[model samples]
Target: MDWNKAADNAQTLMQAHEALSRLMPRPDAPQQTWLAYYRRSAAVYTRVAEIDRGHFHETMFWATREREKAEAMEQSALA
Candidate 1:
């Protein structure tokens, strides 16, 4: 497996997560709404990280899949 490619993709996912995190609602927004939004976003990042960590001793197929899942989660949150 190409370790460098996996690293690059992992970095990309991390960056996307950071970008999404920065888009959080303002501080004055309803507490429940803000918490719910961030909770879902955090779950995606946590799942992606879990998959990437598992790939340390195996293959790296799930990174992309998790990234797609993250994107879908973000889109669903937006909707």
Candidate 2:
């Protein structure tokens, strides 16, 4: 993937993490939502660490996949 695409995906993941963190303390929130958010954040952070260690392709692949999944979950929450 191009650098722009990777950056956008990373940003999306970061935003998702932020949203999830905000929702965490709400008593009415579903448990699965928190778990999904945690997994998404872990995936993004892991990919970022890999990039810092010089693993570009692995970083891009994981970021793209996880960001897509996170975005889907976010949309589902909206619905």
Write one digit per residue (lDDT tens) for candidate 1, span 32-53. Answer: 5555555544544555565556
Candidate 1 Cα outliers beyond 4 Å, as residue runs: 1-13, 54-79
Clashes of 1: 0
Model 1 local distance difference test score: 0.48
lDDT (10s digit) by residue, model 2, range 1-79: 1112343254443443444344343555575655465455556556565545555555566556656766776778789
lDDT of 2: 0.52
TM-score per prediction, in order, is: 0.40, 0.37
Highest TM-score scorer: 1
Model 2 weakest 10-residue run by lDDT: 1-10
lDDT of 1 at 2: 15
